[model samples]
Target: MSQVRPGARRVLGATAVESPVIQPRLRTIPEATVARLAVYLRVLAGFADGGRTTVSSGELASAAGVNPAGLRKDLSHLGSCGVRGVGYDVRALRERIARVLGAEQSRACVLVGLGNLGTALADYAGFGSRGFRFTGLFDAAPDRVGQRIGGLPVQPMTELEATVTGTGVSIGVIATPAEVAQQICDRLTAAGVRSILNFAPMTLTAPAGVDVRQVDLSVELQVLAFLGQQRAVPAGEVPA
Candidate 1:
């Protein structure tokens, strides 16, 4: 008798028999839903911290700036069937969302470029509660090296690889100038950083399996300005 491959159907003469070890279907969550899940997590966290025990979907949706129906659909992806009248349990829902976003596990992060924006981001208080902790800081400037910010001393670029490797860091933050951003990104990727949050104004390329998220302040400001104009001036009308 021929051996049957796991998760595959095997032909036995005219009868097809499925292998005993069946492969489970991959439950792919939509990219948009993933983004919204972060928003929901943030809102749920706030609710939990505020001592709220239960929240209606409408309340959570309003707080998250999403429609109630859409919010329910997003929560459905988590396999949580919320009660019809009572809505969701605040702490329970928060924990569920956090697990899905991997927020329960502490992720060590390394940030390069200790300029103004970089320094401020390093000092941000919100990261700790969200399961992210910056274990290392790197800068190319000699003056920045050995300087301490947010309880971590800044290291020269030479220390990046060693520090990342030592800390088991998989996430990196780049706040360098546009010209040097790609160089720093390349170094981080080479050092085993798989996910990057880029604050530099330019785009940085990475090899397959690496994820890069860009934060362009000017673009966001311009978009907000455009929306503000739309409120002041009716559609299709230009301001004099």
Candidate 2:
């Protein structure tokens, strides 16, 4: 049985296609552990690309920024066992983790709003290596439409639904402004986009079962500013 949201199913060309859903293990795995597992996958891919075949638990944990015990615990959720001395087979472990994270197959995505940030995101080529492909680019402005970025011509927002439905685009990346972000989000959900990566500065409301992840650049910068301020505190600053 597919765990993917049914709304993500779409008719692409002459065939009805669906995104490769995460395996059943997702339901049993803790969300925090799942996140760490993805980090571990990236670390393993780096090792594999460098021609490494095997990895010790300590080395893998260090590269992934986790302790050995915690790394073992996370993999344990996947029923993956590390050899007593040999640690784990790098290639095998990566495959196991990718299966659970839904990274084994490329997921189609569409981007709305082709301003500076949106244009930059569309032009990034690194998404292909990580199992994501942007199949459609869109903007509400007429001037932006017909302009090409990253090899795909920007289309008008009027074409958003047909494109998403035809491409089986399961995820949407919204980089529009605050005032119109919710409207864009609503349109994406209505088009059968099950997950969204919102770079807009404001929050968005969506129908039930739609997953929305908000990435606010200014707020993140503010958090880092707070941390930097704390680091600059003088000694003997224990006063309340």
Candidate 3:
């Protein structure tokens, strides 16, 4: 019998050397840290586009509109750090964030309503890159019942439960009008959707155990108006 090398294998049933096994490290980063990671990634993308190789924490924070200390803490959670004098590697950090966020994998999502914003979101390509797959489209409109948006066929509101059950869709995106926002949310909850990203301009009242994230355009505009008013006022002026 021939002796195999320490790191080599022999043919057939001959002796084979074992290779070093690498232990997988377990990491549990905070949810807040994970959220900031995306902002850092976008900042890194801008740097990459400008041919930048390194970015200081301060620079990244400024670019991403975050605090320097907060950005440093978030990056540190991933076991990544900038050298004493040098900054972080823009490309490497972006790839690391993408991996941690599971951006490469495809996640299925269901969209309710076929209004303008809903149609636009269905047509948006950014969701695909971020592991979001728009698999089902539902609407109350009779005409939109049989329509197709972004290659996904639209189904009537009545079929919402069946489609969600069949496809195992958990993430729901509600884009219905303000009047029917709560009603639609209840139906989505009934269909076993746990998480919802609502675009309707109203607060949704769902049962316990259901997560509803509201994205009200009108409320956003109000916030913008408040900020604009602050800017319009003098630096030392007080608002009534």
Candidate 4:
């Protein structure tokens, strides 16, 4: 006589379900590596477009403004190693890096200001080539609202939520003045945007899991001026 197994008994004459397979979690890549991967991808794209099939680490690093060893180490995180005698396959490496960086997918982004800087960002063609599509443009000014930029209508602040939800936008850009940048950032975060590119001069605070990057042209200029001043100072001479 055959014996029935425990916990394997039939329920309503149906056999017991098998357990689902457990998959291993993916390793977390360093943020620096991620940034370099984007650089590498861009360089590889240029090579591929120019009909180049392979790239040595030294050549790629030089183009990417990074050291060869560091570039190789970063690529190694993605399990890519160049052949012993040959360099990396440009097309293959580009595809791999694109996958790693999620650049293979187009992400919808919304710009929240239509001022001079905002207008320039909206009109930029590079974002599209890099897989970021602008789905909405917004401005608080009445005169700016209803105007069109880069074929996208300048929407009012009132329509921000609707635009974000309707277009499934995940990234937000805040190019408004410092006074209103925080307000815009709050609205964007509440509307389900997780990544923000802030062009305003002030820093923004967001809850955990949200990413905010600030780009201040004035600050950059100030940094350059400081460097210039250092270079101009005579060696071993103290300035009053």
Local distance difference test values of all predictions, in order: 0.84, 0.83, 0.78, 0.83
Residues 133-200 of candidate 4 have per-residue lDDT tens digits of 99999999999998989999998999999999899998999999899999999999999999998888
Over all chains combined, what TM-score does candidate 4 have? Answer: 0.85
Of 1 and 2, the candidate ahead on TM-score is 1
What is the lDDT for 37 in model 1? 85
- Root-mean-square deviation of each candidate, in angstroms? 10.5, 8.2, 14.6, 13.9
On lDDT, the candidate that comes out on top is 1
The local lDDT score (0 to 100) that residue 90 gets in candidate 3 is 80
> Which portions of model 3 show Cα errors greater than 4 Å?
1-33, 49-54, 81-84, 231-240
TM-score of 3: 0.75
TM-scores for every predicted model: 0.85, 0.83, 0.75, 0.85
Worst lDDT 10-window in candidate 1? 1-10
- Specify the poorest-scoring 10-residue window by lDDT in model 4: 1-10
**Which residue runs does candidate 2 get wrong by more than 4 Å?**
1-27, 234-240
- For model 1, residues 134-224, the per-residue Cα lDDT tens digits are 9999998999999999999999899899999999998999999999999999999999999998989887789998878777878777777
The true-versus-predicted C-alpha distance at residue 51 of model 1, in Å, is 1.7
Angstrom error at residue 34, model 1: 1.6
Show pairs that collide, candidate 2: none
List, residue by residue over 103-183, the lDDT tens digit for candidate 2.
889999999999999999998876877789999999989989999999999999989999999999999999998899999
All candidates in order of TM-score, best leading: 4, 1, 2, 3
Q: How well does candidate 1 match the true structure, expressed as C-alpha RMSD?
A: 10.5
